[model samples]
Target: MSVTKTSPTTNTDASLLADHEVESTYRSVNNVQLHIVTAGDPDAPLVILLHGHPDFWYGWRDQISPLVEAGFRVVVPDQRGCNLSEAPDGVDAYRLSELSADVCELIHSEGQESAHVIGHDFGGFVAWNVALRQPSIVDRLGILNVPHPTVYRDTLKSSPQQIARSWYVWFYQVPKLPEWMLRRNGMDNMVASLEVTSNSGTFDEETIERYRAAWQHTGVHPRINWYRGFRRSGSPSRNTVTQPTLICWGTEDIALLPSMAEKSVDYCENGQLRMFPNASHWVHHEREEVTEELLRHLSQNSLS
Candidate 1:
């Protein structure tokens, strides 16, 4: 494992977890080196934040301070194949089982038996798998703007609306074209997609630039590999979630339907769903209300 300090590039970069004191390091976990940003006391209850597609640890910037101040150690990682994290070649390397193992190993790396796990978008999918595959390592599960794996699969097959919205996933199946298109014109198309899919003012110029920097460092192929890998990963063997779960969703998500949220709860033994009518797929970016809700969920039913 290699550890080093992160040099700040902009004012926003400098302010990341500024009040709580931030530590950036690279740890070899699950056969890949992951770049992780951590804050709050090392002894506090752990809470891991997983970011989604085309996003890095910075995606959880808005909620990090709040979680830290509330007496929780927050660990946000640039999952393998994104940002400064090591990206292993091949779509199979990015499979759901492999991604889930990274999280499980990450918890052990922190010297923790279990931790509250929360994720958004693709991260949410990873979180769900982690809870399902290794329930004992997850104290609580929180998913933002993503449905259960089975729900997502069933929706994609049964609902034309979902299939239509997910046209990009099919487009990504092509070998090199999707990567070329995403990288064209200084990543203008990729930047535009973020702005268009999210609610107005969700991603400002500075934020977009921050993402652009990470995208340039990681390249587009590994990120696109997530979609490609999922296509070949096959259906999940275990769908039931025994751990306490919270699903926070933005109803206006262009890619996933709101009905999936209600359906997702069905698979959980004890699960609750909160819908943000006006928020888009980037519900975690909404910050205030979602953060409060997350804190409440994590605080309840202490597993420690």
Candidate 2:
């Protein structure tokens, strides 16, 4: 599904996770190599985290230790076109359906019939769509930011608030300029916007540099093509989520207004929302502690 989110003030190939060390491995899905990071025992209930654009598996660095310590094996993949993952040419290569299929294949590789999922930004987009496509594999869902595409489209048409907040989606629709600007300007704007969008400046000097590295990776055109593909694909097929869902939103997010956030719960059959008044688009990072609590809640709820 396509999302009308703000475009990165920049996108590049800069590393974002500096303080923590990440172990990497590969899993083949859809005839492409998927770079994934696994932490904890292979026998534990798998928790898969997905990162959005200009970010990588390291996006979950802060949550990895806590999640593993909680007795859940955590997995974070660099999706098909981002980071070390295979960057196959073509917009269709990164479609919502294809993204879901990749996760499905990854789960099967770990010898599991189903897995719990948590995604941020574009990764959340993939998570939501995957739940719809393969409810059998989605045990529970935790989403940070990244609204329902249906609500997003309706908001774009009706709510001037969401429209004003999402001016960057249109900017990204431009060809060549975004790539050139990101390479020339670096990720200062993207990082700054991320900081500004969130209540806290998690996108500090250090964090911004890391995001720049991922955005600037080779074949970034196909990576950026994710946004272009969505715009061209338009609204995707909406499927009711059979899995329980926990959605966390930051009221301070500049891209998605709180009203749109409040009104979007009907899409899930079993859904809950946790609001972070001071958080922004990257609520997961801004309120990592609180988001983890919600994850624990999801774990327990699913077990019951």
Candidate 3:
């Protein structure tokens, strides 16, 4: 549980970090070291924000300040293989079980029995698994734009529409081609993909450049390995989530269908789903109310 403070890198905005009083630190969790940025008080209720694929800790920049103002100790991590975090070799290393363990160990490292866990895209996949595999470590669950693993797996098998939209998942199974495509032209494809997938103006030039810096810094292989590892990760034995869950979805998501969001709620004992018709896959950025919803969800039965 060793934690070391680190200086801000090119991928991070020093002024924004200073404005929010965000502290960057590295913690040895599971078998790898993860770069995490935390804000707010040390003793406040812990809220862990996990970013999705092709993204790092900066994805949650919009929510951190609001959460901190709401009296939460917000910890956003560049989950393994994304930004400054350690990228372990091999596809097997990125398995869902391994990903879930990292979150659990992170909670323990923070000296908390459980924390409010929130995630988006690939991050949501990890968050769902954390609640399913280790329910005790998650006080509440917040998901954005990703379905439950079982729902997604089952849908891919049964729904033609979902299968069609998820063609990239299979393409990523290829050894090096996918990585090369993502890295070529200074990662122009990766940058374009983000813009095309989200609402207009959701990703401006400055924000896109930050993501470009992170992708160039870490390369795309380790991140693509998450998709490659998915085929090998297999499904979890238990699919139901026991914790109070809040699922926020953007109806215009290009990858995941909104119907999957409805099915995902079926797997939760106590879950609420809010759909943003105007927003795209990046609901947190496009909609201001999402932060309010998340704050309300996390404030329920506050541990403080």
lDDT of 3 at 226: 93
| TM-scores for every candidate against the unseen true structure | 0.94, 0.87, 0.95
RMSD of each: 3.0, 5.1, 3.1
Sequence-dependent TM-score of model 2: 0.87
Scored by lDDT, model 1 comes in at 0.87
Off by over 4 Å in 2: 1-22, 234-238, 301-303
For residues 36-96, what per-residue lDDT tens digits would candidate 1 score against the true structure?
9988889999999999987889989889888988889999999988877888888998888
Q: Which stretches of candidate 1 lie over 4 Å from their true place?
A: 1-17
Q: What is the C-alpha lDDT of each candidate?
A: 0.87, 0.73, 0.88
Tens digits of per-residue lDDT for model 3, 103-191: 99998889899999999999999999999999999999999999999999999999999999999999999888998899789799999
Error of 3 at 123 (Å): 0.2
- Residue-level lDDT of model 2, residues 1-304, one tens digit each, is 2222234444322133332344577888878887788877789888899998667887777887777777788888988777667777777877787888899999999999998988888898888877877788988888888777677777899987778777877877788987666556555665655566666557666666656656555435666778877776534455467688888887777777777666667788888888888777777777766656655765694467
* Cα lDDT over the full model 3: 0.88
lDDT of 2: 0.73
Q: Candidate 1, residue 179: CA error in Å? A: 0.5
Candidate 1: RMSD to truth: 3.0
